[model samples]
Each structure stands twice: as structure tokens, then as C-alpha cells.
Target: MTADQSVTEPVAATGAATMVDVAIVGGGLAGSLAAAVLARAGHRVTLIDKRAVYPDEFRVEKIGGPQLEMFRKLGFIRGLESVACPYDRVLNIREGKLVDVSVGQAYGLPYADLVAMARGQIPDASSLIVDEVTAISCSDDVQQLELASGRRLKARLVVLATGMAGALGYKLGIKRRVLAAGHSVSFGFTIARRDGAPFDFNALTCYGERTADGVDYLSLFPVQAGMRANLFMFRDPADPVMRDLRRDTEATLLRLLPGLRPYLGDFHVTDRVQNWVMDLSVVEGHLQDGVVLIGDAFQTNCPAAGTGVARLLVDVERLCTEYAPRWLMTEGMGKAKISEFYSDRDKIAADQQSLKMAHFRQALTSRNDIGWDVRRRLHFLRRSLTHRVDQMRPGWLAQVRSALRA
Candidate 1:
């Protein structure tokens, strides 16, 4: 199959139409990965997106822990390594003192590069269509998509991976119910030392000092550009400090996190300051016929909790690798089939965990109640003590703990 170079008028009166086993509406990480997995499984898949190339967007910039395992299981780990900067250690600090160290292999890259890497996994380049899905009509047997270019796509199933683009889903009567509007704010920017010297730490995480500040933590990790910083906050979006952070990032960051000053050593932002005010939401009225919603189309995550990628990975894995193939083998794409994916044990766990973590992070960061205040201090103390013990015994304590678990 050859790629469609451009979106043109329909080849036939009903507008040029192509048939596929699955039609994916968005080409973000989830959509692209699903397309790659299904296509590799020998399914005729069509991936459509508004942009030919994903733009530099302030979204999930790193994939680690279980997310890495999922990527490897899906056969995209090599593709990830090719485009991302890998780091295995993160120095975690609080109030200018070491709290703990996270030791794990992780990859940092622009979100667009990650999406491109997933798309590249598809052997047939022509399987991806660069066009806009203006509308969709889904039924139990066949699903149809109308493109802005008058091209039409028909498939047995439709996967809506249109991350946070509620417009398309709204047209289908799917509505996003806001769980928490403006749940958190996230800032993404690159940083470099003033003297152009390398930093001592491969990756660093600096937690906020005070609950009043509404700051969660500042995560500095390596990317292709340089040291990339992601500042997650529970503060109001209209706060004057937000503007200051965008205009005078280096200085404002120091002011918010004074302990960060000595570690950064006269650094400045190297690129455009990108920030997002995320709303925790889930789509309602979506458990319908012939269609499945994944990723942000199903629900949005709190950046502070760092669960977005994990949730979406579960969506793609459970839907594409398991439910989707089984559904395809059956007669129709009915609500009963769609509900199984929605109610899948792993998918539900991931989504619920995301919401639970979101609330936990917010409470830990800004809640001033007596119980939370005590919990906050104990949290850091426990981490610090664990780190100290680990430094003394190396892997001995971990091995002992693992043995105890067994």
C-alpha cells in the first residue's frame, strides 16, 4: 500500500473511500501505538491526524517505570531509545536537603518525537493518512469517517484517540464531565548553565518547601535540547507568579524554590516557555456502538501526579492488543464489546489510580489541614531516612525486603 500524498476530492461520487479493519482518529502517542500494534498484527489500519507532523507540544515529555515496560512489551523500546535521552538516576531533594534518589531507566524526549517514533513503527507508511476527521458515524457493524478533504474512510471499528480535542467527540454526543477544572498547572522549558558547563546531576527533582506556595515539585531531566525542566503546581492559573514564571522563569523559579538556586548555578531558559492548565475530566455517554475512546479522549490526568502516560499506555495495550483483536473476530462492534474495554480490570485500575494520585498530590502540596500537615512532614522524613539507610547498605536492605515479601 502506498501513502496518500495529499487529501483530495473523493475518487468516487461518495468521495474516495478506503476500507480498513480499524480507523483511528488521532495520531498522538496512544493512537500511533495502537495503529502500529494492530498493523503489525496484520490488521488493515488507517491513522488520521490533522497535522502531517506532530508539533512541539508541552505534554508528557518522559516515559519511565511501568511505562517503559509497556513500550518494550509493545516492541517500541528501541524506537524510543533512538529519539530520547536516557537517564537512570534522579536526585530528589526538599528544603535544600537530599530526600531520596530514584534509580530507574527512563527516557526523556519531546512528545512529538515520541509520537513520531511510534508512527514510524508502522511498516506501511501509507497506512497513516494526514487529514482531519470532520465527522464520524458509528454503528454496530461498520463505522464511517468524513474528512475535511471530502475523503471518506470506512472500517469495522473506530478508535477515538483525539487527546483532549472534545470537539469531535462532542459531535458524537460524547461529553467531558469536568472532575476538577484547572486541577493543576505545568510548565515545560529547557535550561542550560550560564557558562555552558554540564550539570553534576543526570536528573533532579526538587519538591516545594511550603504548602502556601501551591508548588508541587520541579523536575529537571535530560532531553535532546538540554536539561529539561517540568514544574508542576497546584496554584491558581491567574496567579501573578504564573506570568512571572513565563517571563522571568529562572528568577521566578528560584524565588518559588529558593533551594534550587545553589544547584542550578546561574542557568537560563533556552527555549520558549510552554505551560498547560490541565483539567481532570472523563468523557460520558461514550460507551456506545462501533467506537472506543482512549487516552485523553477518555479522561485527562493531572500532570503533577505523572499518570498520563501510564493511563494511556494501558488504554492502548488493553484495547488494541486484547479487546480489539477479539472484537474484530466477532460479528459486530456493539456496546457489549465496547464496555468490556471500558471495564477491563487493568484499564479501570489505571484510571482510578490516576485520579487517586491527582488528589493525593494536591493534598500533599497545598492542603493545610492538621492531618495533612503531619502527613507531609512524615512523608519527607520517611524518604530521607530510607535514602540514608540505602546509602549505608547499598542493595542489602532492598534484597532483605524482597526476601521478606517472598
Candidate 2:
């Protein structure tokens, strides 16, 4: 029987637990997608979460680049497109002047909607157990989970896809090592013109003008309701500017990014300013028997760097597609089997690249050192020059790049 079709219900009074091939401990994008993948593979899978519908949260709202390829490989690109508002062009600007136009496919949507789309992919309605996972006991043979409803689950393997919630993992002796505390802050809000006119551009990106501002960049993209704005920064969360930005968003934005004034004519923040402070971290002591940590449960990524989704996609793809199924066919779930996922070349590369990009974005935005000053200048200059070249001779740059690869 398929995983979704053969859900074993919890037995009554005597407290007998349901047995499955895999139990996913979070219904976020990672857990839900992993559940869908494993269930489709014919493995008995149970996805446990506290809520039936994901709440409106400020997380990865836009995804593009290699993420599309990964989604296509996993056969979810079409589903993703259905829920997302697609855009193909981005007007990039720096200090009120044009930088370069980025031409590629990207998508924007509410994180809740994205999570719901992933959860809907599970064919078995009963496979998703809407309950809190109170505690977990793991071993080489089988893993047992105690739910808040007094029901229990016994699975051959436990996939810890819990994003940033460490209580359950803590009970299992899995601890997060904070690599950088208060690494960055992100603000999300919708914007619209006072006259109710459409924006001049489909999507826009405004880079920070001054280093002291600690502002990295402001990204404006289309969502279902209105134009969504994401302001990323490296400033202290306790700063008075933060309060001003939240209370007087438009005024503070214009003051900080005066160049944006001409581009955005008579606009106002149309919704509550949702903000998040991120701490870059990774799980320690996670390598154990019967349980595996994936996504933000294993490492936290900077929103400005935009690597959280990439890292999680790599984890799900590698674990669900490669390691998990192969391990299940063997005798037991142990450290040796679990280590294969953590050590997978692709997984390790994604994790390392995420950390690297986090540091790079923070430095490029706020570092005013002589060395960084030159690097930052050349970074923009290089892009500007390339744009000019491509504009003058269309398709020339692409041909040169292709030849270089050859």
C-alpha cells in the first residue's frame, strides 16, 4: 500500500501507537515536502504538526535561481507556479541610478500559502496528523513520538524538519550552536501608491546608499494583494531607527533611501510592518540513531543572503531522494546511515555556501574598510559595465560566457 493509503490509526484505551516507515516532525516547507516525497515513494509516512494551516509568517517570500531547477527535479515546479505570482524582470538600482536589469524567472507569495501548497501534495489525507509532538525517543530499531493528544507514533525513522523550534530536539540532546547572534534584521510590508496606480516597474531592488545606515537593500515585488517590500539590514534591532521605520515606515524609508523617492511616487505602507531578527546557527550533537535534522532545525540562514530555501531544498532532495530510501532498505537507522546525509557533498556545499553568502552580504553592505570599499565599488562597477556591454551588443555576453565554459 502507498504511504498515504495505509495510515495506521492510534489504537484506543490501551495506548497503542501507530507504526510507519517515516515520521516527519514539522509541517513547514521542508517537512511537508519531505513527507510528500517519501509518501510518493511508497514509504509509510506520517507528518505531525500543531496546526492544520500554516500561519501568516514572514519567511522566504521570494524564490528563484537554482531553486527552480531543484523544484523541477522534484516535480513540484508546476505546483509552485500555481500559488506564486511570477515575474521575469527586476529593475535594479543603486543610489537612485540604474545598475542593471536582471532578466530571469522569479516568484513571490506569502510563506503561509507556500507551506499550504506543499502540504496539499500529500495524497493521503490521514498521513498528516495535526497535533503537537510533545516528546521523542529514538533508537537504532525504531523511534517513538509522544503527541499532546496522548496518541503516539512509532516509525522506522524520524525526520526532524522543525524550523528553529528546538524544544523537541533539545529533549533529544540536539543543541544549536549560535554562529552569529543577531546577524541581521528583516522587515516585510506591502506598499501602494496613494492614487491607487500600478507601480512603474514589475519588480525593483534598491541598494543601500550609505554604510552607516546598515541597510543592505530593499526588494519590491508583486504578491497577490499588493506590492510586497522586504527591507534587509545589519543594524542593531534596539536602535531608535527601527522603531521609526515601523511607526513611520514611508517617511523613514524616504529619509534612508532618498533615491527611492523619484521611483516610488506618493506611496505608503499598506499593512503592518512584519520584522524578524535572525541568528545564524547550526545544530550540534544531531548525528544519532533513527532521527535526522533538516532545514532550519539544523542551520539558520540570513534572510538578506537568501540562502535558507536553497539549503533546505538541498537537504530535502538529498535526504528524501537518496539517503533515506537507501537506508530504510537495510537493517537499522544508525549514526553511520544518518551521517551519509550530513556529509553528502551537495548538502555540505549548500550549507557552506549559505554561511559564506551571509558573511559576504553583511560585509559588502556595512564594511567601510579600505579593502572592502574597493571591493564594493568594483562589485557594482563590474555589473554596470557588463549591463552596458550586453545592451550595446545583445547576446554577445552570453555567447562569450558559453565559449568560456567550453
Clashing pairs in 1: 3-126, 10-16, 11-16
lDDT of each: 0.92, 0.92
Backbone clash total, candidate 1? 3
Candidate 2 lDDT over 1-406, as tens digits, reads 0112133344343588889999999999999999998998999999988777788999989989889999889878988999999999999999999999999999999999999888888889789887778889999889988876668889999999989999999999999999999999999999999999999999999999999999999999999989999999999989999999999999999999999999999999998899999999999999999999999999999999989999999999999999999998988998889999999999999999999999999999999999999999999999999999999999999999999999
Expressed as tens digits, the lDDT of each residue in 310-389 for candidate 1 is 99999999998999999999799999999999989999999999999999999999999999999999999999998889
lDDT, candidate 1, at 103: 99
Error of 2 at 242 (Å): 1.0
| TM-scores of all predicted structures | 0.97, 0.97
lDDT for model 1:
0.92
* True-vs-predicted CA distance for residue 354, candidate 2, Å: 0.3
TM-score of 2: 0.97
RMSD of each: 2.5, 3.6
